[model samples]
Target: PFDSYRDAASTAPGTLPSPAAVGDLLGEAGVGSDDTIVAYDDTHGVFAARFVLTALAYGHEDVKLLDGDFSSWRQEYETTDEVPPVEPTDYVINTLADDAPIVDREAVEAAIDSGGTTLLDTRNEEEYEQRHLPGAIRLDWMELVDEETRGVKSGDAVETLLADRGIPTDRETPMILYCNTSRRLSHTFVVLRSLGFTDVAVYEGSMTEWLDADGATEAAD
Candidate 1:
């Protein structure tokens, strides 16, 4: 279901969908603009966070995330793969949120040029070895997730982990997170925000767009 939702919501690979598309997505799901949205996924809430971030970008204020994931839910309750029928509504997009925590290619380039923002690469080691943005810190998004719970680690634990990597923990520290498609990076965005990282942002058009636009990259050492 999420796979279908994602495909329908996206305009292009590694890009956020238009606000109108998001409105349609919610409407088709029988969700209203002001309704409470609880998002979850099978993959340790990565895709759920992606949806939550997308909703937030469109000024949806009541979005919530399920702790853990569908597997976690199954462990506690009965499970079913049945798709429920729904009546679509007219969910209209009024206005996009101001100063949304998302960055484009040009903004990412400017951040790099300014040498002020921390660029974090949330991909696997093999992917990093193949190619990554110059000066991007390598931190697999899984590193912040608890394997047992399949949820984000505690805020204190995240702080310690980030400090171990020489990353700033101050709320004002500017950090830009990215993965190949920006989906995995959304989980990291939520985790960092929970720790009061006010200036953190996701590069929605991440490595995919970067490579397409001829942005330079470096292989791992």
Candidate 2:
């Protein structure tokens, strides 16, 4: 289904909804635990990826984004107002995995201090040059996905990009990724995992919380 008001099993704009709230919305939307969800959005994979990540946080697995998104779908097929049949399921969130997909500000800072975790900054070049976390491997979110159609780029495209930049290619490396709201970073997180990169976490606090906490930032020379 297209990314619409109905697709949002959570609150809108700026930040993610609470775990209980997301479970409630998804449960009512008839998303079962065993089901596979393909979330897509017109605003790029930004919102689409976020929805999948949120589902994972609430203990829902087997979800993925429609790689090309709704724009690609519309380009090929006629639109319809008909809605799919939905069976409401009482989806209670299972306890989170021991290795959660998210990390907090303090955890990130500690990781940076210890040099055990790498930070992948997913903001734009302008913002990256203006200010960024020290030692963050800069990668603008737009590069991972298309600008016009908002569809995700191919995995080979990203692999080549990372390799050309001399970025680390190890799968077991610990990494924390972030964007303005951590929304865009989710896309990269998924792509990296698909390429076999492990121990990746999304810093949901992101730059917004970093600034709020008066964390240190570095600028381009």
Candidate 3:
């Protein structure tokens, strides 16, 4: 079955599905332990990570994230107007990770005030224009990987992207990335870690919680 979180969210009225529900949904969709599953979202990889973690929790293996996400896929590859059909298979449910990978509003507030770190916002320009956490710089995720932005032909693409944004890559500075929901941010996390960024972590709840709060610091330009 071609299950979508967006669809579930609309019907269920929640940001995420319960772990058991996710397992049941995937199982009903026939997702098997051996299946090579890929999950993605346009906002950020937080949602994808949830799904991946859910699959792993339910004992499913062979899961991988789609590089660059759906938008990037469309930009890189041409597709036809017609939709394609999908086949469903049984999936085994295995749960992993005791807690959700989410950092709360208070943690973000502390992180911003403490300094000694670079706060990167991976949302698009339009979203950044609406609002963002205080001291967070908009780094638009696509710009990081685009050949035109950094123009570097080789080594450590993530570092090159950060450097292009005037962020130093030395290990001394801690780096934290966040987005509306952290789906794209997860991809950023993966890229940065691969490029040897040692002190990096993602703000899981991200701007969603910050913006929803009563008096959290938020700015718009």
Query: How badly does each model clash, as a count of residue pairs?
Result: 0, 0, 18
- lDDT leaderboard ranking: 1, 2, 3
RMSD of each: 2.3, 3.6, 5.7
Give lDDT tens digits, candidate 1, residues 1-221.
Answer: 44433434454465766667788889999998678999998999988989888888888889877879999888888988899999999988765689678889899999988898999999988998899998898888899989998878888888888889788888999999999887888888887776778998999879978988899999988
Best by TM-score: 1
Q: Residue 170 in model 1: shift from native, Å?
A: 0.6
C-alpha local distance difference test of each model: 0.84, 0.76, 0.60
- Name the lDDT of candidate 3: 0.60
Candidate 3 residues 123-150, lDDT tens each? 8988887777777877886665544322
Q: Give the per-residue lDDT digits (tens) of candidate 2, residues 154-187.
A: 7788878888766777788888899877678878
Q: Output the worst ten-in-a-row residue range by lDDT, candidate 3.
A: 5-14
Q: Is candidate 1 or candidate 3 better by lDDT?
A: 1
Comparison by lDDT, 1 against 2, better one? 1
Model 1, global lDDT: 0.84
Clashing pairs in 2: none
Best by lDDT: 1
Each prediction's TM-score versus the true structure: 0.89, 0.88, 0.61
